[model samples]
Target: MAPGPIRVAETPLVSYLLRRADDALVLGHRLSEWAGRAPTMEEDMALANMGLDLLGQARMLYAHAGEVEGRGRDEDAFAYWRDERGYRNLLLVEQPNGDFAVTIVRQFLYAAYAEPYWRAMMASGDATLAAVGAKAEKEMAYHVRHCAEWVVRLGDGTAESRARAAAALTELWPFTGELFEVDGTDRTLIAAGIAVDPQTLREPWQRTVIQVLAEATLEAPPAGFMRRGGRSGRHSEHLGHLLAEMQHLQRSNPGAAW
Candidate 1:
């Protein structure tokens, strides 16, 4: 007789959702920081809008994860109560926003991965996950367009701008590999048709990145040792400092809602 289907623990699913939520949340915060600091007022507003879109996606994901875990924790609890070590956001998201070029390059890389990832997730067997994926995919499409335009504008612009764009792309390329690294959580869900295998995204991600770089007149960076461990809750030191600021109000005034 054929073997029965493998049953994976619900915990892995919850963990997987939380990791995706954390990525959106942390990156949203980072993007919001550019609100008043962008090169122009129009760009400032654009970044702020995109940031809020990502935060909205996180809120939905966190709520769904809470339900899946059978935990009483709510979105606020997950967002405000988790310590640095508890966060599973990609190190790429938590990395310091260096300059305008750096921010655009980072966003471009993430959008390239996210747009396709969400498109795949829209077919998930899990209804809530599929719904969130649908909504997020729309928002990510806009983000991808915006970031890609910036990449091209800067990369093919004046000599100095092109140099800066190239430098940012090279600096951020290493982090892109982590987005495709799968773990046990991924394996279980992928088998169940409830999640996309991240590995499947690598080829399309590379194709998209290379095409955009070509349009921007930028060369692809050389591959090197890929830094990882973010999904395993091991993050760079920058996350600790970011969390301290992000959780300050909640930690200081616990349960003191207005």
Candidate 2:
């Protein structure tokens, strides 16, 4: 018999973990959208592989969260049964993949932060989280390298590609600020040695971004107004559309599996 739904408490720790999982899941879906639409066959496969990596990370994180919550909620439950407001992914990730340049810039910016964030999490007090960090850090390192190479290529290519890359940078730069926004949830877990301090990651993240942009011959846009609220269950309209598409199969046919 199938198990009934489990009532899970949204504790600070669970929220923190879900935020991470949601980030991976949403971004993975975005990458998956490029499956057959990429500029070349090699890139098409590469994006698919990267998407799979993020999905794998999300599964691990969601499983760990279910365990910590002491609930029967598995990865599938947390992934498919949640409403838009129930998600806690960063706004940057949930944004629509505008163009090839946009997708590359978005991935590069995110992987830049994710690489260091996962590396720092390797020292987490929680054993499961530490193990997750070890695996994810390596994947994120590769993501950073792949996306950075694309960013440079796009930025330094022909006039149209350069313009597109520059436009992508301008559009995506404002969303990067939310990556390092620390809050009460972060503070509580940081004290417990269960979370990496987002503030501490900012310097390393910026250094990587600057170096990569320099190589691409693209200038980093000056910081101005930044978006927020994804951690608090608030997201742009894009998330709702994404959730509708992503959750359709599972929502329409509950418990149906291959």
Q: Number of the top candidate by lDDT?
A: 2
Lowest lDDT 10-mer window, candidate 1?
1-10
State, as a TM-score between 0 and 1, how close model 2 is to the true structure. 0.97
lDDT of each: 0.89, 0.92
Judge candidate 2 against the unseen true structure and give its global Cα lDDT, from 0 to 1. 0.92
Per-residue accuracy of model 2 over 1-258 as CA lDDT, tens digit each: 444333458898899889999999999999999999999999999999999999999999999999989867889999888888889999999999999999999999999999999999999998988998999999999999999999999999999999999999999888988999999989999999999999999999999999999999999999799999999889999999998899888888888899
Tens digits of lDDT, candidate 1, 132-249: 9999899999999999999999999999999999999888888888999988888998999999999889999899889999999999988788889999879988999988898887
Candidates in order, TM-scores: namely 0.95, 0.97
In the predicted model 1, the residue pairs found to clash are none
The global Cα lDDT (0 to 1) of model 1 is 0.89
